[model samples]
Target: MVVLSRRIRSEDWKPVGVSELEVNALQVVRSVDNRSVIAGPGAGKTELLAQRAAYLLQTGASPAPRRILAISFKRDAATNLAARVRQRCHRIHAERFDSMTFDAFAKGLIDRFGQALPERWRPRSDYEIMFPGDRDYREFLSRQIGVPPAHIGTYADIQAISVKTFERRHLVGTPLPLDGWLQPTPAQWAAGCYWQRFLHEGKKSFLSFSMIGRLAELLLRVNPMVQDALRLTYSHLFMDEFQDTTPIQYELVRTIFLGANTVTTAVGDNKQQIMRWAMAMDDPFSAFDGDFGATRTPLYNNYRSSPELVRIQHILAQALDVQAVAPVSKTVGTIAGASCAIWDFSTPGVEAAHLAAFVAAEIKAQALSPRDFVLLVRQKASEYATVLEPAFVAAGIPMRNEAGMVGAIMLQDLLVEAVSKLIVNVLRLAMATRAGRHWTTCQEALTALVGIAHDDEIAQAKFANELDAYVVTLKATYPNSPKSKVASRAIVEDILRFVGREKVVAAHPAYGQGGWLDEVLDSVAGHLLASSCNHTEWSSALDVYEGIHAVPLMTIHKSKGLEYHSVIFVGLDDGAWWSFANDQIEATAGFFVAFTRAKQRVVFTYCSHRGARTNIATLYQLLTNAGVKKVKIA
Candidate 1:
């Protein structure tokens, strides 16, 4: 791939206000010693970013700076944008498009940071961070530390718990005695609280990748080499899904490129800022004026939807605080024959089942291709997999689960499994041979290994003694058991064998029978896991491609810049739907985003009970009052 002169003329680009806003944003970024962009939902932020990158690379006066670094919150978004840029450029610089998820970008930083750490402080693993989904460690911490389960739960729950714990010890004295007891100092209380948490659930392994964002910010701020190296290495910075960046990430961006002439543009829809769990928040609208000196623009003329569908969204926007700047109050989607349906599901399970049934019906009635529809769950919560999956399966709908690798054993999990297996092996060997001393040592290892291998440990003798004894046992049992072959290669092979490669592939959601699943999976997994050649290489799994039959479900954020023949808005007006402050903006913004997705028709469905009934009534009222002429509800 090589860079060439711009093939697309300046006149070829669309001039939506948002498009102009994006252009202006880039111009400011070009002038900024450093810059940040803030965009609201339906703002065409990503499109502007892609256009800006393509524009710069195509129009650069001289040697275009080394590379243009475009990052996304998701690997898919990054890869998609990279491809779009390649197409837009009319030529691709294979190395110039440094599009990667922030995590991937941070690992490069970690490589440098690891070397700077004191020898004693060297990290146990140099690999990517892993976050456990089960909250098992949190539960263990709660039990061990005498904190209620209600306190230390989810990531949010842990923060709340930490705050409560901090307050309980420092603000209130321990078990206020009937007779006056000596009150502890605030410092002493805080120290005791810290000790309690550390003694219980303070394992370093529990740190999530999000923490890397925090650490990376600190590194860039503190380390001149890191800051200089980044700014010097990359001259242009573009971010997609910019609204989803957390404060920590914002700090990281500031530290890396402060006072640099490098062009930096962040494009994202604030209404679509959905990753709150990871601390991602929509870039405040005011930030554009303050941080980047950006001018806001509206992309009101949606090219995706028809007039009727577009009008419907305008009415729904009243439910939220922000109004959608709809593109011309018209829908002109490609799928003009599509139909929308609204169904009332009284409960969560009912909603799940109704969605499943609706998808199944659509596949049959429309004779639609499986690949045409996608199911977009609200979050990556287990509720979808546990409850919704079963409903879909029970409905006899052959749906493709697009959820990423949940069933597969993560590397952290593998480490935990190996430790458990090692303890069992030691105990079993000692029990069979009746070696009391060996058994006792092995038991001590099992106890100590739990904390030592996983967390910092002051005692090294326990580890050394356990390793020496394990070697002795291996020597004694080499011929009888599969011992003495604990080399890295052999260990890997053994683990894979124990993991049952066949079983893993069989259990994979994507691997379950249709178009291109086998082919796509093979290509993706082959490229990603090329180092491992022990497994069979699959050429095609067309059977997997054939299974996609669900009514397409997707988040409104993903649906942006995309259109469907028919659109159904389910679970609308649920109090839970707009529980957060940002939720209101996203929901109203979603009304616009969702409406634009429909080609011919749109259906908004919610439960009859609760506020849903009132919600829909108000929607109808707004639509009729907004010159919709005739609004019908069935």
Candidate 2:
């Protein structure tokens, strides 16, 4: 509730190109005292964060020769904030700013201060960090816990349990049960054993993602030099999306900089704390005030949505008993009456079809781009994918579902590996001018290429004979050419064509008419031509592919920290939004987060029945009570 002094020193203050509300937030950010800003959706929190970094440099709040560390929850967010800061701040000041995700920061700290780690925590020279999909680590955990590998759920679940265990350990300074997590269950025992072995094997090899936080905490607690060095290195620390901070992450942050002279600012919206399943605290503000002793400043003005949209959001917040801050809209116009509506359908398929048709119509009528829209589901599964994806495809609307993209990327990798092997074979065959010298290698290459081309033995033989003739033609065509150059370009293309890459990709369930698969193929071909198609390079390409402009279909959880001009919230019924087990606090928070992502318009859809359950009565009551008009369709 305390506001920083607004009086600015004339020399230190400069126009940072923000509105008055944002300016107020930036002033608090630039102040030397620790501060926490509660920023709502589209509140320009990221802009304020960037300006804060710039302000620190321009005003000399962060003295020269010291860096400002800005940490975000995700790598893309960190990279984006860093880019914006560099653009706005002075060249010299921007140069001193380092931005990275929390994991990156922790990993870097451990890498730099490994020698300072405790003997048990110290990593051996052969130590390597294995992630969730690492086969060896999964098998090792399976063996340690006596649970079959199939029962381990997912890498994400394993990671969550690991972090939860570490959080307990950090809280009590030893691994003890603070809650039901300590119950003597088989899973709990496995988790405990897995944590112990993970640390035990750190002297040789270990697998981890959550352990980074624990290791960083240990280094900062035990090694004062490391703390002092970091304190001296960073004059200001800024954390974006602080609500998503796990207990261990916050502990690490507090351990290193709580009492230091470094000015710290944590910006987040408690209402947007929808990542509870990820170990995010339900009440993040208390930690800011009680744990860090930071002053709180709330940024209430919503600059992203129309007045009508803001009104609806306020109603939802009030119903959920969340802090309802009425956002003053900076948007110019009112949304159309139909902009917000609840569509009720008799079946899920009908609902999906109508939704897709509505999107197509909106894009055409309003001159909107497909990228402006998003379809958010409560969960990503076959239930939604089967109904929704075909609907979009039939409607001629482009949609990018993350699950599908993942499949496409996996397929792309397979194709790339096949291409690489084929090229290697072609080059080997070209080098075997005198047959006996490299006959075995040439034969192996030909056999592999033919095997990759067809399943039937007769077809494989035909393809192999054709490939041999084509190689002879290629050699004759480029008699003096370097084998690699010929193989990389011409031969690679021939192999891709012979293997029916396009046909196979087009037949994939993940393939859309938008030619995303074609784009992936083109990218793979480009990489193959450059002779640089490696896992890392292909993975980077996948990241780029995911960023392409298209209508996104994802869960509300995955949709956090992203905004769209129009958001369609599907399955707004009771079972999807409310559960009998809890008070639905987390679900309401998630709903609030999803609704606020809209920039101009929002729509909610629900089926009359979800499997054996009737439609969500509570959701119906809440919407009708809030005066939300409903359109029922059969």
Task: Please report the candidate that would top TM-score against the real structure.
Answer: 2
lDDT per residue, candidate 1, 84-111, as tens digits?
A: 6655554334235677777656654654
Question: Which lDDT tens digits does candidate 2 get at residues 1-634?
Answer: 1112233463657546554545567567657788888887888888888777766777667777899999987655676787677567644466678888787687767666766776656654334565543454445444444532454445444444443333333322332332324444334545555655665654454635466666778778788888999999998899998888877677788889988888888988777776676667667668768877888888877888888778887787776655566878887544466657887799988988888898899888888888789888887444677778788888987565643432234322333233343444454465345435444445544444333432356765666577678667766654433224444355456645654665433323222223444555454444444333322232232323333435677787767777888999887765665452354567667878888899888888877576322344555565666678988888
Candidate 2 residues lying further than 4 Å off, grouped into runs, are 1-12, 125-193, 201-204, 320-323, 381-383, 403-549, 574-580, 612-617
Error of 2 at 406 (Å): 2.9
| Candidate 2 to truth, TM | 0.69
By lDDT, who's the top model here? 2
Error of 1 at 428 (Å): 47
What would you estimate as the lDDT of candidate 2? Answer: 0.65
How much lDDT does each candidate structure score?
A: 0.47, 0.65
Model 1 Cα RMSD, 1 decimal: 16.1
